[model samples]
Target: MLFHFMSPLALSNSYFLAFRPREEKSQPRLSTPRFSSQRTLFLTENNQKKLPFFQARHHWMEDYKYLFKVVLVGNAGVGKTCLVRKFTQGIFPPGQSATIGVDFMIKTVKVGNDKIKLQIWDTAGQERFRSITQSYYRSAHAIVLVYDVSCQPSFDCLPEWLGEIESYANRRVLKILVGNKVDKGDEREVPERIGRDFSDVNHFDYFLETSALDATNVDQLFEQVATRLTNDMKITDERVHQYRADATNSSSNQGGPIKLIDRAQTQLNSCCSRQ
Candidate 1:
């Protein structure tokens, strides 16, 4: 029950409490109350007071650098480092040492009302460091599987990267397929259809052909990822309104969804009726 009490008190906005027994054999005692907000509040139920443990993460934003973790994975020499260098440090410097394990960088991108600070992990694309680099995949919210547009072997190996991620990465991770180094048609080996097929079968969020050497669609790609991630974090008004409506509807039908009773009064009534 929602009560506008004159005094300040803690409340569960639109939730109910459930009891779960502790499995420990030590104490001879009792069950603890667990808060569940799966149900809606009812206006008819009276004498309801707030029980602790209804916690919700509030929406707030600071610098976009701390909100999300994104990972980059693909074959060796697929321009993963070049793409990152172009975006974060500016200019894809040549003759640099290949990634030893995983390199990290930060970029803040705006998405609707929030700014998401993306912590991008560019994993080593070589076969040797797979063990070392694979651990980073577990924490990523989004994954970009890169393939060189000019290399069929790199494109063909895309499935292996995808398979690894499915086996061990974040279960809810969003994925995107990227074809890098599009500027070099002289060396181009993979066709556009290859990228499309990978995107379709794996349910990629988006696909783009980019030239990290020239900096193409690099910003747009990350922006889209940042936007999608921010959306995933939010509890929107639409969902809130729909949940309220569903609960209200459920409460009004036939027998009230769950018959709630005040424990003290229920015991008293049982005794009197028996007598």
Candidate 2:
């Protein structure tokens, strides 16, 4: 008998969501709702091919309604990676390592009738990687600032993080504040009320406390991101439509002679039809 075991981190990275909107159904649906299973072969340290079990929805090469970039930023060891792993893979990475410069993963979710492909960028929280991380802020549609509830220093650094966000991120980017590790009741140094107040005072669009280890609010957090972005995009598209309509009306009105001739032709056609 042969036995093989995989670590949590390896398992988390092995599978990723590749959701495609169903062609036949009016509503978006995944082929494997529970867990889309996919297999990948990789060369092991011993130069032998190994297959790891992972769950993700397999989709065709091209199909998506919208693509969004979501970036995560906070101090080191703030459970940013763990939060992402928990949300993306439904696993708590006990031995998660700090991100180097940056890392990314793709997860497709259905927001209303729109199939949104979220490109989640997990940046290194270390000061040395500040330059690298700051560059990603401008392109992100949503920015999630994460802090550990049990760590006072992390909470205290929110202002500094906000400063960086203001300096680097888009002026209209959706900002969210997340206090992670709320499961640590006795270890918690920052109260929920304080976190909420800070978020309100700092003008965050929304605030929530989460525990990646226990999978509390992890799914809700990402869902909120997708929902908010989808709504915002819809509003923007409506505004653009209104602007175009106004522009077309203005252009038509400016065609004074052409409009009069067209109106005369319209009246002549109506007269002929009446006859």
Candidate 3:
């Protein structure tokens, strides 16, 4: 039921052990305390509890919290959706349809001992969706800017896309410039040299030519983002999600819910250029 947001960009492994408050029914007076790591969710007499953040179970709702907001953007046909789809679902969404105004999805991945929740937002690449969609960029811990390796126009639009993310989205957004559609190597219009040069001079976190079609290096891109967020200053939800409202109406113009994966179905889901 997992959806790969874009084939080139990955949402990597995250491990979260939630600590919750549970009371033991069996009462026994003992000088020493008991420790069991076997229990997936646990509680202690002390004021602490643990739960797995990604798994939505009855006990976890009261314990775990959202960790990070991960956002993705690019031109309409640049494979943004494909890259995510491939990484999350392991299979791309079949066929293609423009992501309406916006799309929301979340996947929890592990970073070392702690599990970090990744809130993924995939927006419409079309220019018309810009106003309605740019709002997703704010509060994003990481912003993935994508472009098609085979298309000139999409590649040319990198700066404007980067600027939009910078000005409107999270000002401190971590960026990865993706040169997608590397499978179309023969058809490439933007040379790797140019893409590499721009990424280097701009000091982008990372850049690579990837093929969502082949599922290449998609996961690596996200791993880098996760590492940055975990190692850098850890920002909390209040400062980031203060503006995002979930209690409001479903169809409101503002950002809303995370689309949970339905077990029955799935899709195949890249991009490049930065300046």
Off by over 4 Å in 2: 1-62, 256-275
* Residue 101, model 3: Cα distance from true site in angstroms: 1.2
Q: What is the lDDT of residue 49 in candidate 2?
A: 25
Better of 2 and 3 by lDDT: 2
Error of 2 at 114 (Å): 1.3
Tell me each candidate's TM-score.
0.64, 0.72, 0.63
Segments of candidate 1 deviating more than 4 angstroms: 1-61, 235-275
Please identify which of the two predictions, 2 or 3, would achieve the higher TM-score against the true structure: 2
Clashes of each: 2, 1, 38
Candidate ranking (TM-score, best to worst): 2, 1, 3
lDDT pick, better of 1 and 3: 1
Residue 215 displacement (Å), model 1 = 0.9
lDDT of 2 by residue, 13-116 (tens): 10212233456353223232121122321112112423232212223213465556688999999999888888888888788888888776667788988778
Worst lDDT 10-window in candidate 3: 264-273
CA error at residue 112 for candidate 3, angstroms: 1.2
In order, candidate lDDTs are 0.62, 0.69, 0.59
Error of 2 at 134 (Å): 0.6
